[model samples]
Target: MTTADYIALALFLALWALYSWLTAGSGSRFFPRLSLNRAMAERRRNWIYNSLRRDLKMIDTQILAGLQNGTAFFASTSIFAIGGCFALLGSTDKVEDVFSNLPFVYYGGRTAFELKVAGLTVLFGYSFFKFGWAYRLFNYCTILFGALPMMHDTNADRAKAEIAADQVIQMNTIAAGHFNAGLRALFLSIGYLGWFAGPYMFMAMTAIVVFVLTRRQYFSDARLALMDPVSDTKDKQERDMRT
Candidate 1:
């Protein structure tokens, strides 16, 4: 690989890590702003703890099932992606031949092509592991959910119910954290595919991807919807009382 490829790769990795960190634990003093991921995490906590007061937890169980199913689906997708990358390795000759004739394509030679494929393989592999672990964590959260005191029992000792719910919430959040990491990798792979065009293209695409993701996490309509609007309403009410 040339110096430009190395620099591009480094840029890709650094942005990936930075975005991951920013979207992770929104409680960090460094960020100061909440991410959509963290906001959803709070909702998850509310969901679990709120179930304690309900007579039937069928809804909660179904939510848990949905989480497991979604994780499984992504995990399967990652596996398929890994298989596709491996298949690509076997067809590098054909790919290089095609690159040779395409005027718009930047043929980085066999070594660069192979390196790019290997990197893609690693990305998919990382996503697979993340999803796998997330699935297990969700399973653990299910068990923890089951261990939560029954509605009748919760009525007797609300504190105990709170403690148990907290456990499940933490497990669910951790599972979600892994799932988010995997999803982030999947999104970045789209940009990583740009390497076939050239390192500069790769760097440009990676930056574009990061910008899109950051906007979605921190400045999107989804984040606005998830944010609590009680403060504005409460302030309005206070002003009315003053009048």
Candidate 2:
């Protein structure tokens, strides 16, 4: 591969590693600290006293059920994606040959090359579809959060209910994070396939995409609002006082 391609590949790997490091922690790091145990405990206590005093057991059951469902969905989708990537290795040569021929192609005498291309294409298609659907499901979870019943009874002690709600939200957020991580893995696998052309180009494109995703997650307004320490601390303090 050319020098440019090598440079790109190096950059991509570096950025990917960096992004992983930056997002590794849920507290004192990353944009969202909502899952920090102390914060969650405070919210749970407030919710319990304010809205779930009578139905605490029921709320706990529902929260556990939601967590199980979300975790299962993510795990199944990720397994499918990994299987698809492994299947593609069997088709690499066919893909390489096809690309080599370019605009007008002839398989010549290479049956193995043809088979490899077909396999890689199928695998890539499966990965793309799985990743796309997982993303849609994650978006649906966000909508589910919005649809949760809001407590309107000012005099009702709702500490338990609030805690249940917080747990549900936290579980959903964790599921969404996992879904994104799966997508990242799929894309990285695809980029690795590009290494057949040469490691340099593979690294370059990977780096560029990684940089874009990191910037969006860390610098975007959505991330800022969620991660804002001042606001988050205030909310935690108020909830603690109420509890």
Candidate 3:
């Protein structure tokens, strides 16, 4: 409820937006690297396209089931988190007393504390909706995947098969995007907890969280592992030229 508090909240929101923009694949020139999300999206397309070439699709359905189950689990967790936030609000007096006694803690009275709890509730609610929608989209994607032409039909009409496969790929990608958004909110909530301590700690924690996430997206070993080897690509190009 202070000027510093307002500024810290603004910075927190700005950093969240910035991270989203960078990871959504628009900051490639500045980053000069492919993100893990984008790499996995490519893999999703490959997976869908590969299904068009196969007859037995039990494995593909299993993968879809796994994706749906994961999204459902996160959705359920968000609901639980929202309930916990409400419970926290109900016990504000006890928490406020604890905060007052703690060294280096900020107790901004009942109203401010309530507002902070409200914000946390909103974050969890947003995540819940995202995960819920992702779960639905994944279900729809499974239906689309099932509708894809069989191997013989695909061979007869490859163009139609490609179009059908592209549909499945797009649906799967969109579902994944929602799921990632939900996960990001959950991660950022950790930084938000610093606000309960003080605005300065809030800003520092938000910066630290963003730094870690950005590093993971651009520089982590997982990203490096996903990258296609330069030598392999060059060799493939040379082989194509010779052929």
Index of the highest-lDDT prediction: 3
Score residue 184 of candidate 3 by CA lDDT: 95
Clashing pairs in 1: none
- Candidate 1 residue 123 Cα shift, in angstroms, is 0.4
Count of steric clashes across candidates, in order: 0, 30, 0
Best-to-worst TM-score order: 3, 1, 2
> Could you give candidate 1's per-residue lDDT for residues 151-232 as a string of tens digits?
8999999998899999999999999999999999999999999888988899999999999999888767677767666744
What TM-score, over all chains together, does every model reach?
0.93, 0.46, 0.93
Where is model 2 poorest over a 10-residue stretch in terms of lDDT? 33-42
RMSD of each: 4.2, 10.2, 5.0
- Whole-model lDDT for model 2 versus the true structure? 0.51
The alpha-carbon lDDT assigned to residue 86 of candidate 2 equals 60
- The global C-alpha lDDT for each of the candidates, from Candidate 1 onward, is 0.90, 0.51, 0.91
Tens-place lDDT per residue, model 3, 90-129, is 9999998899899988788889999999999999999999
Candidate 3, lDDT over the whole model: 0.91
lDDT of model number 1? 0.90
Candidate 1 stretches greater than 4 Å from native: 26-28, 232-243
